[model samples]
Target: MADDSNTEYLLDASLSDADAMAYVPDPVEVPYPDLEYVSTPETADTYDKYFYFHREDVSFEEALADIRDCDSLARGLNSGMGYQDVYSPYGGLAGAAGGVIGNAIAAAIFGSAEKRRIRRVNLRRCMNFKGYERYGLEKDLWQRFNFEEGFSGEAEHIRQGAIIQQAKVASGPKPATEELGR
Candidate 1:
């Protein structure tokens, strides 16, 4: 009989392992936004001023999602379920990781949802503006509706729906022979 260990070794060598393993020499650093790192009163005031002045360019839904992301990170950091890297010079690697995850989550929501849900939420919020209900004009809707809840839930729903739709399409029937001109 053939040696079992030798046969196993041969099988392992023949099988392609590219998909099962990766040899990343260095871990890529994740880019994260940190509002706490905004040093000085001037920097803080700048964001606030921008928020007030550029309300037209920015939507309430986007702001709400950002807030939720930050809030989630803060909660995670405070809960102590995170770890800190030994080589972090700033002693804030844990918070940085949290921020990275939060930002990634926020970005993923927008990308996966096709931005449909966020647009819808913003539109709904704009339509519900009571202050300018009489005029029916397009204006800064945030002045009337406070997006405390953010559009995170709606965005998530849209993302999930898109994923399901994508899967359904992928698993759908093959094109007709006539349609394929086969």
Candidate 2:
């Protein structure tokens, strides 16, 4: 129905470490825990649902380019850019191994066409594929290529944990926002 293979948004530091820093917002005064620090491969899987469908016609390099765009969008969001601001071609990097090596590993993971077909169907029902476009993809590649979706339910569970922790931080305690003299 749609390509899902082009879904995952992996982060690679192409920008000099300095430039990458610019994509992060300044620390908030309230001393909140860093969401970025808590981001694990599992958390990424929450968004990884986008790649559930894939197209075989598209080359591996093209697929990786698509994923890179997804990564860029993710960074922009983390930097405080609105969803509309980050909207454009190629949101972040794609492919396995951070988009540097492209999809060799992914193909290996999807060895059989039958397995891929099953994965795609499961992915659509389980993950939040809507975010994938901002991450890149009109439709997931797995649909086109019949590739199996790679994301696991574990990602959603872990994200829920992080959300709970963030909520606790927000509601637990506070320091005065105003300067001492003011």
Candidate 3:
């Protein structure tokens, strides 16, 4: 039987000059496609553009109905009761007299004011629903490319540019571009 309990291992740490200068593959460069710039027409600046959308005229009856609806809602908010007469605590007859007088005064003054307020509210609601409110023009423009008949390409370009410019301005200042050689 052979005793193989004291085996030792050795490592080589020497390399030739040719082995030291081993070959390394060169990095390949990728070519990118050139971007082509198109000049916008001068007429784009001169053209008058307006965002137009289809809006039906509201009739007197429609306005009246809206006013009535608002008034009814107001009445509901006021404890489901119409205007109540003011009461005096001195006497029943005096209270009745005061109530009558107060009701007359309110009808004469506040009645018209209340009606006007309701009408205004109704008008605003109607305009909002019919897409006639403020900023509606811009909203209509962005909604679809369905421009009016005989609209020129130059006008469209100008309008789109204006919208883009407005959006950029609203978005605040952008980060500065970095220089190649600093």
Candidate 4:
């Protein structure tokens, strides 16, 4: 049989192997994988900071699937398990009042700041569970090539997907530090 010992490890990668799969080579002082090492120049004078994940052996398809699954899980958890049956309340005079109530209720349930925060936390947990480690970057730099949650509209979706796809083999997300100007 073909040697799948390594491939099997990838399918159910455990946190125990995290250190063995370092994304960044240790300054070339020691032997390392032939993975590409990326160094980005400063674009903006300042940046809002956030963390992203990196695993040396992950394929683009795996990363994209993991991100999508996490996004769905986070949103579903934040929105709750209620079956919100929408009945049009704009039918008559009394219905107008019901419409207003429906709007208020919807607003209260969806897209609140708290809900967004909870979603982010859940996303982080799910990604971590998949053996991804967090690395920090300036917000401006990250948005250039990542799939962030809470972004809407078709154009934005296409742009994000394209950039991420283009960088399918992108590796080595360095932590934002004092020198990087985060």
Candidate 5:
């Protein structure tokens, strides 16, 4: 029902790397064992629901712009329960009650957790289409950079921004750590 295209968000002025860094929070690391990474070609697996977009050729600023574009696309797809044209055939008080009931039904069917999950899916799909890989992370590490679309608080938005800004900059595997038995 939506355009669902990559060319939706246009960038006029390019941002410098230093400018992009301002949006990211402090660094975070997800050590091995607890940190399992996967790339979702279809969609994320149940436990590996968290993800960020990465591409080899893009600059950090370009990646940031793409992230914002995908976020916008995701938001457009999940703009929440607004079945505005749902008017009842009945008149007066009965019609008002029926409208309320209809709206509630729509919310139940399309709002909440499922919508948020779809938002994430749509975001990943967008990034995938734009030649980016979807790198999945375990929840704790994912939380450092992402927020559920429908449930984002101020902190979550900041975290989302953090990931958007950091995705390309932190693009590859972390450096090796000393083995436990070593």
Candidate 6:
């Protein structure tokens, strides 16, 4: 009789005992210079004298909130969500059917919306870039805005007041001489 006893079989040649996972190299982190390392004398002079002249009037958070509010408003307006037809149905149909004339009329109606959107987008980007440069906050504008409550002028004032109060507390009381003049 043929040997019926089961013999141990070798593993498939393609399957190795060792781990077959591909090597993954570690991620390389590029170093970014700190503000002091990057700032030139001229840039510092301009920033302090010109750009930040009104820094005390508005805190970073307030400015950021205002930027957010403006951005939100711009987005809402640009979305054309609430637009209503001003023209009668007949006029609308005529305008739509007028070929090149219709196209011109449509452009005239919507061109301002496009312009406003572009302006708002640019303004938001500028604010974000400026905030990053001034504060050394690693987050981009949208990321920073995510941490704040929804924008409101009243809320912004309250926040600014709180910030000012904190600053006063952190700095401690002014001397009698310093207070005497004010």
Winning model by lDDT: 5
Q: Candidate 1 has which clashing residue pairs, if any? A: none
RMSD, candidate 2, Å: 22.8
Which prediction has more favorable lDDT, 2 or 3?
A: 3
lDDT agreement with native, every candidate: 0.27, 0.29, 0.31, 0.45, 0.52, 0.31
TM-scores of the models, in the given order?
A: 0.16, 0.19, 0.29, 0.43, 0.54, 0.24
Off by over 4 Å in 6: 1-55, 78-96, 99-101, 108-114, 117-182
Per-residue lDDT for 1-182 in model 1, tens only? 12222111111222234411211111121111111232344543333211211122333334333333332332211212233333434558786776667666655555434443343334333423411111111123212211222223322322222222222222223312111000
Local error of candidate 6 at 2, Å?
Answer: 70
Better of 1 and 6 by lDDT: 6
The digit string of per-residue lDDT tens for model 5 on 61-145 reads 5666677677667763554676665566777888887888888787776676767877777877787777776545546555544
Ranking by TM-score: 5, 4, 3, 6, 2, 1
lDDT of 4 by residue, 25-118 (tens): 2222221222222435552232223445665677665665666567557753444423344466466666666766776676566645455566
Q: Which residue segments of model 5 deviate by more than 4 Å?
A: 1-44, 76-80, 84-92, 95-99, 105-110, 151-160, 165-170, 174-182
Q: How accurate is candidate 1 locally (lDDT)?
A: 0.27
lDDT digits (tens) for residues 1-182 of candidate 3: 12121111111113232332221111111111111222234422312231211223533234323333432343212111235766567768888888777777766665554544443344345434543321112323222322221111213232222222222221222213211110
Greater TM-score among 5 and 6 belongs to: 5
Off by over 4 Å in 3: 1-82, 134-182
Clashes of each: 0, 44, 0, 0, 0, 0
* lDDT comparing candidate 6 with the true structure: 0.31
